[model samples]
Each structure stands twice: as C-alpha cells, then as structure tokens.
Target: MLVKLGVNSGFGAKSCIYMLASSAVLRRQQLVIRCLGVGGYSNHNINTNQKPMQGVGFSSGASLEADVENVLRAITPTLDPNRHKGQAGNIAVIGGCREYTGAPYFAAISALKIGADLSHVFCTRDAASVIKSYSPELIVHPILEESYSVRDEDKSFILEKVLGEVDKWMERFDCLVIGPGLGRDPFLLDCVSKIIKHARQSNVPIVIDGDGLFLITNCLDLVSGYHLAVLTPNVNEYKRLVQKVLSCEVNDEDAREQLLSLAKRIGGVTILRKGKADLISDGEIVESVSIYGSPRRCGGQGDILSGSVAVFLSWARQIVTDENLSISSRNPTMLGCIAGSTLMRKAASLAFENKKRSTLTTDIIECLGRSLQDICPVP
Candidate 1:
C-alpha cells in the first residue's frame, strides 16, 4: 500500500521501515518520497515506468529522481586519502553457529564491499573457521557458545565472557548487524539478547534480519523503542510482527497506516518490510524504494541487505548534523534505509542482467561497487 509521509518535529520520531517483495514486480517500478524539510510536509512521487531491469536511470519522467539521487550522494561518505582505516565504517555481525555460517559472512562482508572500513563476525567456534575460510578479509571471533558446548553451570560465566569480548570493541563499531545465521539456541540466543542490550546501551545502530528477527519477535523489549534499530522482515516475518504487535492479520487494505502504527507501537524503530516494493517507515514517516530488482530470491539476499544497511546507516548517522544536505528527515536511520534499499535494488538488477536466473547473492555483492559508482560518481 502506498502512503504519503507526514513531518514530525522530534529528531528520532520513529523507526525507519522497508518491506521487500520477492517477485518479478520489483523489477522496474520504484517510488521515493522526500518529506520536505523539518516541521514541513512535502511529498514527491518518483515512480519509474514499469519495465525490466535497466541500469541506474529509471524512466526520466519521474520528477523527483534527482532528489533520490541527492539522498544517496548526501549520506555516502567521500573517499579521502588522509582518513584512517575505520573512518568510513566499522561493522560487526552477531550471528553464525554450527548449522549456519554463510548468513553472518554475507552480512559482514557486504558491509566491507559497500565501503565499510572493517567487518567483524562474532559466532560460535563450530562456524568460525568455515566462515573464515570463506573470506580471509573478515575478523572472525569464535566467542559465542551454544547450549551443547557449555555446561549448565558455566552458562553465566560464559555469557559474561562473550559480552566482555564484544564490549571491548563495541564503541569502535559504527553499527551492528544482528541475527544473520544465529541459530535459536536457548543459551546462544540468551547471550545474543544481552549483547543486543549492550549495543543499545552504547547507542549503536542495529539492523536485524534472518533468525535475529525471530529473537526480537518473541522478546519485543529487546528492540521495542530503540529508534536506531532496523528490522528487515520478509513476508512471513512481517506477518508475525503484525500478529504480535498489532494483534491483527496483515492488513493489505491499509498497509501504510498499519505499518506506521506498528512502528510507533514498537517505540519508533524503523522497519523495512520486504515485499514487491521495499516499503520503509519510521514511526513518523513512510517511504518506498520501488525500483525493479532481480526476481531471483536467493537465500542470502536479506543478509546482504542487513549488512549494506548497517554501513549506510552508520554513514547516515555521521552526516545527520550536516547543514548542506537538502533532504528533510533528520532521522539518519530513515536516510540510511533509503540509501541502502536503493543500492541493493540497483545491484540486484545489475546481477540479474548479467547472470539471469543463475544470479546468486555473491554476484549481487560483487556488483555493489559498480552500482554505487553509477549513482555517486567521483570527480
């Protein structure tokens, strides 16, 4: 459901939300809404003609195309020769267990591919080496413990140890992507819950996806009112959120209103609802990135999005105070979702063009650079 944005006076009005549709309909149409400036309301409809995957430019007819372009350029950091290694972004993924490693790796590595300076993975020992073998670039920490590995008596000690390992570098990280391949081990999830609390306490932004969605759905307070938290949920996950929070079925008739209410009810966190068009909403405003992306619903695409959002959100947070940007929303989380959703759709379209039906998540990851370059060219 399409809805216009309303301006809110508060800085962190609500959470930014995006919904993705895993279908061919997502291939061409994209609409972006720029809710004027602070304390004012202006809605611009940037809808491209529905067509197959074309490169960066959508139908020239969409009037606000330049505004969308400006949003991406404004949030993305300029490459500087004198900057330190971690200046661009530092991202950590809190997931990966014996059964799942690729999700965390995808989430972590995508952050780097999208220009994050450093990417770290905190996972169980069983998955650490395998994920490391996947990429030597990642800094893998095998500190998490599943119930099977820890004695009942050691749970408390081990949990504190895990938190300590994370706390050492927590402040250094720009953002944290939680729940990539995190298995729902009672013990492991319990540990991750504490980690989430600490991240929140430290005021770090988090993008939650995959199994991470499962953890917060059951325990809403983990992310309940944190505006910096982003939840990326596909069809089923979105439905669950509707059930638990709104206590109703997925209301397609008034989805925009429902989404806005959901975000507000959850204490103003941004939600990216994954569907045909990536619909985003913070408690205060709702926006959409309807650009046509690939129809190939690969398993790890969401992981890529989670990682990409972490990087962009970090960048957005850094630039929120800059007076040069034209956009209105002071909410860095919303801007980050806009930038990340735009880039992901562009890369997906590019990958689908090259690999057709065989397109994998890795192919899309590889295209991130080219996509960013296309949108924000360097002088």
Candidate 2:
C-alpha cells in the first residue's frame, strides 16, 4: 500500500518526492561540508565527467613519506598578515573523560599550535576543568555526562540537555575531532552517538580516533557511508576495525588494498591507516605519507594527526569550490588526510632531529609551524 502510494504518484509528484529525499540526503551531506567550510551544491558539477588535476609524483628517495612533505607544502595555506582571526581555521575536539583528559587537550591545543585560529574541546564535566586548565587558549565545554551521574529516570532529559549543549554550537565549528581520551562508558558512548548524529545533521566533518574508533567499531551506521568523515586508527585499532568490518584477521601483505576496500565498503569515507608509513585511502585512490618519523612511538601522536587533519581538511574544503577551479572530482577529505599526514610526519622528523631520544608529542606539535614554514615559506 505504501509502496503503491509511492509509485502511483504522478511523474511530477514522484520527481518531487525524489527531490525531497535527495535534498534531505544532501542537506546532511552539506552540514558536514559547510562545517568544514566548503560551499554546497554550488561546488557540485552536474556533468560528472570532470577529472582531477595532474601533479608531479613524489620525488626519488621519497616514499609515501616524501609524498607527505610535498603534499603539506602544496596545501598549507600561506600566512597572510592581512587575514583576520578564524580565517585560518576553527577546530573542535570532542573527547576527554574521567580516565583521559590529556588526549583531547593534546589534540585541541595541537590544532592551535599548527595555526588554527580557534580550538575547542567538548568533554565530560570531570575532564573539562583539567583540559581547560592545561591551556587557556582552548574553549572547553563541560557537557558530556557519564551514566553513573544520571539516574535512569532522567536519562532522556539528560540526553536532551547534552545534545542541546553541543547542538547550540554545532554550526559554528569547522570540524570535530572525536574520541581522543573518550572513555568506554556505556552512557557516555550513547550520548556521543547523539552528538555524532547532530554533527551529521549539521554537516560537520568528523575525525574519529582513540575511543571514538571503539564507538564506531560497534555502531558502524554512525559513519558508514559519510564521505566527509575520516577515521585515524593505529596498528591495534586498525586490526580491530578489520576484524569488525571485514569479519576477519588483518592481512599485512595486502594492507593498502584492504584499506582501500574498507573505505569503499563503508561508503567512500576516508580512512588513514596509521603505521610505519601512514596509508590513506577514500576507496578510490591510495596514498602514503612515509616521511621519516621518530623511532619513539609516543601515545598521543595520533591526537596530533587528528587535530592537524581537521585543520587541513577544512582548508582543503575551502579551496575546492566551483569558483576556484573547474575540476571538482577530488575528495577534500582525502586531500586533507594527505596534507595532515604529511605535515605530522615532517614535524615528527624535525622534532626527532632536535629532541632525538627525548622527542614527545608536544615536541612534534611545536615543530608544526616550522615544518610548514620550511615546506611552504610565507613572505
């Protein structure tokens, strides 16, 4: 009956229904895109025959590692004295809990150190004060609530309040870095699901890492086919992702192809498989950023990548407009991942060059600006 009603509508009525459905889908898509600072349908080319621009391959002695450096140079916006605040970028990190606050702080502050104008953190009340205390520069929102704090009778009310807090500022953000220090609390995860849905509704780009990966691993629908989302996972996280999505063990020999397939299977969302050489793919093209990094595999480096990617991805989206160029074939998320991975590697290499055995995530973050300056020097 419902199917018959859907089908029996006049051709024009059917077209209207289709258009309405498409508009809703595109609206959700645009919410994320706009949050990343990219304009909507204006950038879409109806022809679908457009091609991407040609580029020089990564130089000799340059593996995916070398590619990262060059891509960083290519995408890092030149610092102009004339530009005002927020023009560079605005980013938010949506993680941090009782168990972990340093991760979100690391991710958010790193965005600032890397040149974003504003950085925000949305964390649990317990973690908020600590993260806020770590840096006066970040705008910390103490909104997330753990289950232990709320009674079952008030769950719906509390959930709505949490959603309201995040939703109020949803459209203002360019990108959200989810799952840094996010703990494995059932109630907290449920709240984050609502937050993800809101971000999706607002068209906000999301970079999932840390415990955020854990949430998505369990509920794949949250990010399944969202093209604007980027997932950064380490060796262990990658292994788990493979197991959950592919229902099998990791195959190192065909890692790149498998990663590529994973992104495709998940609806063209971008994935940055962090490893000896960070492998990135949007299911279509595979790229690697293997620049020499420190031997010291510190814990919070992935946080830096998540934050850095948010900024670069936002910038890439800003530049890939119809007015700027005719070729709209490229994926801004892919470009952002490429540029972010590249910059992080170069910074790590520079940090290692200086700090050597003493290198840390903070030290690498400190090198972000210098790395950018070295790659694409501003006048």
Candidate 3:
C-alpha cells in the first residue's frame, strides 16, 4: 500500500510520496477557501460600527473593514511548551548573489526576529560564505548558479542539481521570500523560474519582492491564477506591473480601483502596493495600512517587509485554514499583508523615534518585537 511503501522507503522516496500527498491536501484547502468566500466567521456576528471596505469598480468588493490589530492578535499563536522547532514557522529566502548579499540577510534574519522558529537562505556559492559570516543563526545553502559560472553546455545538468538541492527541503518550508538580492542573470533567472513553478505546484505560499517582482512581472502566468501568491511591489515595481498588465500608468486618484483591476488581471493574487499608505487588494476589496513610519527613504526596508510578511502570512494561513479563526476577512494573504505592513510601519516609526534620521532597516527590525507586543501583549 502507499502508506506502507512510504514508511519502508528511504528519505528520498519518502519525501517524494509526502510531497504528492501534501499537494493533494493543498488543492482541497484552496477549494475550501473558494467555497467559504464572504461566508467566513465575521459574517456570523457583524460589528454595527465597523464598516466593510467595498471594492470600487469590482462586484467582488465586500468591503472588509478589518480591525488589523485584532487580526494580528487572532493569528499569532501562543507560546506553548508542546510546540517544537518549525511549528511557529520555517521560512526560506531564495536570493543572494555575488552582486548583492545584504538584502537576503536582511530578509532571512528578519523572519527569525519576527518569530519564525527557523529561517534559511538559498543563494550562490560566492555569496554563501559572506551571508554565513553575517550571522550564525541562518541555515545557508549556496545552491544557486549564475551565467558567469554556469557554462552553456552544462546548464541543463546544473539547473537540475540546483532544483534537486531545493526540492529536498521544499515541502517542509511554510513560506518562501523570493527576489531579495536576486540579481537578474538569464541563467539564474531561468533556475529561479523552475523553483517558482515547483513552489506553485506544491501549493506553498510565496512573498515576491525585489527582483522577484521583476521575474513575475515579465511572466505574469507564473503567479497568475495562484491564490497563495502575494506580490509586494514598491513604487517603481508597481508602476511597471500596472503598465504591463493593465496597459496604463499608475492612477493616484483611483488607486483602489487600479489596484483591484491589477489583482483581478493577474487572476486574483493578492498585491501590497507600497507607498506612504500601503494599499492591499486581492481583486476583491482594497484595504490600506496608513500608520506612518519614518520619512527615511532607506533601502533594505522592503526586504524586512517581505520576510515579516512570510512569517505572518504563514501563521495566518495555518490559523485560518485550521478552523475558521475569528477575523473579518477569510483571505490569509490579505491579512498577512495587512499585519506585515502595519507592523513594519510601526517598527519604522519606533526606530525613527529612537534613531531619528539615522534609522536603518536593522533598527526597524529590532523594533518588530516591541511593536508587536505593544499591539498584542502576550501573557
């Protein structure tokens, strides 16, 4: 029987069987979400004062006037002695190349600081040692290959080897943070494409940012129609996506409508369009997290957002899908984006309060725990 074979087989064989079973379960989970729609827990008891956000120009807009702080508290699991490693979250960052290393480090480490039990970095050989030296906490794998190192004749073999390395641990990861410090090399992009495809096939949620946005923008089909996909695009990136998909520029006046259309065009994947006020939509409704962070235009903040989101979203997904957790919206991706954005902004504000104009990404990350505690105090 399949069960007997799985138990008797070696690690490789067992993993293959487990992955197949997990994929089937994930498909069923998505089916459940589709059936639930707006009939989630919030419908049972509506707050008269709190209003739902209506999606402008889209019939799917049942305005989700979500109390974000409540959603964050609802999803964050209590610290339990019964819980072991990887139970909280096991997140991975699929980036870090010769040209860039700090971005991936910021992301992978941010996931840990934000309460993920374990964090990992999958990068190139050249960047691995540097990334490892940055911190001893991360489990770093230098499995990625670029054009300079990969010869044309051996590209096929190298690509398979890279994918195999990731496949060994793919099923165990709760979420993947893609594109931070991921340089745009043709061969490297090709390999990353395969990884994204595999992740999509396995039904794992992915937070795409940095160069990852670049990859998905060109090939919208990679994330199109995949409900678990969350795209966190900054000003420039959002502009490109709007131009490419909707064939128009970013419309500030009709921001929510444009965002809703963009998500709809991409087959209902969630999008967090970052700016002074973060706008999130899943082609259903638009929600904004305008809690002011610092005015500092520092780099690497996006990495922090991406990593924080992966953990929160993973927790949100686990909680929502387990049994209807009490929250306004049913979409974990949207909730994750909201929580992550709110936390990031609060942390940034706190960091700026302390460091003033000198606030850096690390400073913001350090404020995450405190900001989270401020909103939802643990007993």
Candidate with top TM-score is 1
Q: Tell me which residue pairs clash in candidate 3.
A: 52-63, 53-63, 53-64, 54-63
Please, what is the TM-score per model?
0.85, 0.82, 0.83
Q: Over all chains combined, what TM-score does candidate 1 have?
A: 0.85
Candidate 2 residue 247 Cα shift, in angstroms, is: 1.5
Q: In model 2, state the lDDT of residue 83.
A: 49
- Please give, for residues 1-379, the per-residue lDDT of candidate 3 as tens digits: 0001111112232234334434544444344445545322222112121222221122233233225565666666666554457767889999999999999999999899889999999999999999999999999999999999988999999999999999998877889999999999989999999999999877788999999999999999899977788999999999999999999999999888899889878977889999988888877667787767889989999999999899988876654443334333556787789889878888999999999989988899899999988876767
Evaluation by lDDT, superior candidate among 1 and 2: 1
lDDT of 1: 0.79
lDDT of 3 at 238: 100
Q: All models: lDDT?
A: 0.79, 0.76, 0.79
lDDT of 2 by residue, 238-276 (tens): 899899888888898887778878887787678999998
Which of the two, 1 or 3, has more TM-score?
1
Model 2 regions lying over 4 Å from their true place: 1-66, 322-329
Q: In candidate 1, residue 100 scores what lDDT?
A: 98
Looking at model 2, the pairs that clash are: 31-202, 31-203, 31-204, 32-203, 32-204, 64-290, 65-290, 65-291
Candidate 3 runs further than 4 Å off: 1-66, 321-327
